[model samples]
Target: MRVVLAEDNVLLSSGLKLLLNSQGFEVAAIAADACAFLAAVETHRPDVTIVDVRLPPSFRDEGIRAAAQARRDHPGLPVLVLSQYVEQEYAGRLLADTRGGIGYLLKDRVSRIAEFTDALRRVAGGGTAMDPEVIAQLLARGGDPVEALTAREREVLALMAEGHDNAGIARRLVITDNAVHKHIGNVFLKLGLSAGDSGHRRVRAVLAYLRRYGGNAPDATTPHH
Candidate 1:
């Protein structure tokens, strides 16, 4: 897939371009500032954009704002937000449009190339790829929104937030597809996300997961993969 990368760090930008190229993704454009980033996106219209949360000048949230504007300009544009911290508020904004094709991950996770690339592919293909640390932060702050679920059910829901379908969840958890379905059904019921189509319900469940634990704590050491 073609990609537009927006990061202010010069060394990291070069490294990411090389890494993405090695992983079969075309780096269509790379920019170090918000305006340049938007220009690249407008010019190349890449399949996905990998963006840092900060950028030149203010270096606060310029990149994310640009990404949001890009999505508005071209609805459903895929974006993978890379950040040093787990910012739930930013994540909420990214998903506010409810159009999917979005991801929010900590920058350190990129070192796990296989998982990171898989997340990029998933987001590009119209799926969610939230970081486990972000989920953990959300979980730590929320009042156990999913406390009704059994351990296995919680596991299934967690995998769902990681962009896994029934088949993938089954493979990872060593469960039958039927069992996965049953657990997911129970999850939806418990989370009050049963009112929509399966795809919509999945997105709602993920959103619920995020809002339930939308605390501003530092990320946990736990790995989601």
Candidate 2:
């Protein structure tokens, strides 16, 4: 895979370039600011992009905005945002696009090579990979619809949002695959996502969870596909 990375920190960007290269991913370009980052996206058209939440010029949300703009300009472009904080609002905005091929992970996750690379690949392959911390934060702010879930069902839904499949969720939660399926079914039922719903039911469930944070919610009646 090819990557265009955007991070203001020289040490982190350089280290990431090396790490990605060593992991068999080509580093197409690295940008320190949003302008350069967008330019690189247009220039490299890389398979994926790793962006920081903040960038130069403002350091508030320049990177996130640039990432959103890049996605707008190049629809379905996979993006993985690295942030020092959870920034649930920003995360919600990005995820609201709901095109799949998205990720939001804490900066510290980069040190865990296996996890980071897996997330990168998952996003690149048109899947979601939200940080567990992000998911926890969203879940903590319980409200209508989501509040209907049992504690175990909520746990399963959280893992599903993190790009885990049934087997993976089972392994992580130390539960049986049958039990995982049961919980997921209950999550779908509680969320009002029927089996006949158009998009991947798991994706829709995650989207419903994300809708509580902010951004336009996916049309539950329409097929995400």
Candidate 3:
């Protein structure tokens, strides 16, 4: 995938550029700050953008905010937000705007070159690759909104958040479609939400799940994954 690299740290940025280059990804442009990063995206329109969550000037949520802006400007564009820590708030914000081709993980996780490249490829292909640490942290923060759900229902909810629909969730879980539907209903009931509330409830459930896991929103630097 064609990629735009954004990071305030020059040394790490260059190393990552070289690594991705060797892996056959074209480093379309490199930027040391959020403004330049946006400009690079406009100029290159890369298939994927791997950006550090912090950047020049204020060095705060500029990168995360920029990533969200890029998604808004270019729907379906793949964006992998690399951070030093897990920020549940940032992740929630990203998901609230769009669910396609987005990722959030710690920067150190990139040291496993093959895994990182594979994640990039996945996002470029229109899939999500959230850091397990982020997921785990989010899961630990608060009470599972679906905690009252039965085991099967919880299973369905987990798969659903993973972007699996009823059919897919059923198939993966080796259950019949009828069973999946039943579990889904149970989930909705347990969460005390109605049919028309699916979308809102889904987002709420996710947010709740993140909170239950002791996850905090994005700070300037989150040491999550």
Tell me the tens digit of each residue's lDDT in model 2 across 1-225: 999999989999999999999999999999999999999999999999999999998899998999999999999999999999999788888767778889999999999999999999999998899888777775664357766677778778778878788888888888899999998888788777765655555876678656743422222211011
TM-scores of all predicted structures = 0.88, 0.91, 0.71
For model 3, give the 10-residue run with minimal summed lDDT.
Answer: 216-225
lDDT of 1 by residue, 1-225 (tens): 899999988899999999999999999988999899889999998999999998989988897899999998989999999999988678777756568899999999999999899999999998988887766665553245566767777677667776788898888888899999898888788766754676646766766655555543233234324
Off by over 4 Å in 2: 212-225
Give the clash count for each candidate: 1, 0, 16
The candidate maximizing lDDT is 2
Cα lDDT over the full model 1 = 0.81
Q: What is the C-alpha lDDT of each candidate?
A: 0.81, 0.83, 0.72
The residue-by-residue lDDT of candidate 3 on 75-165, one tens digit each, is 8779989999887777766655445677777889899998788778877877666675665455443354535656556555555554445
TM-score of candidate 3 against the unseen true structure: 0.71
Q: Report how far off residue 40 is in candidate 1 (Å).
A: 0.8
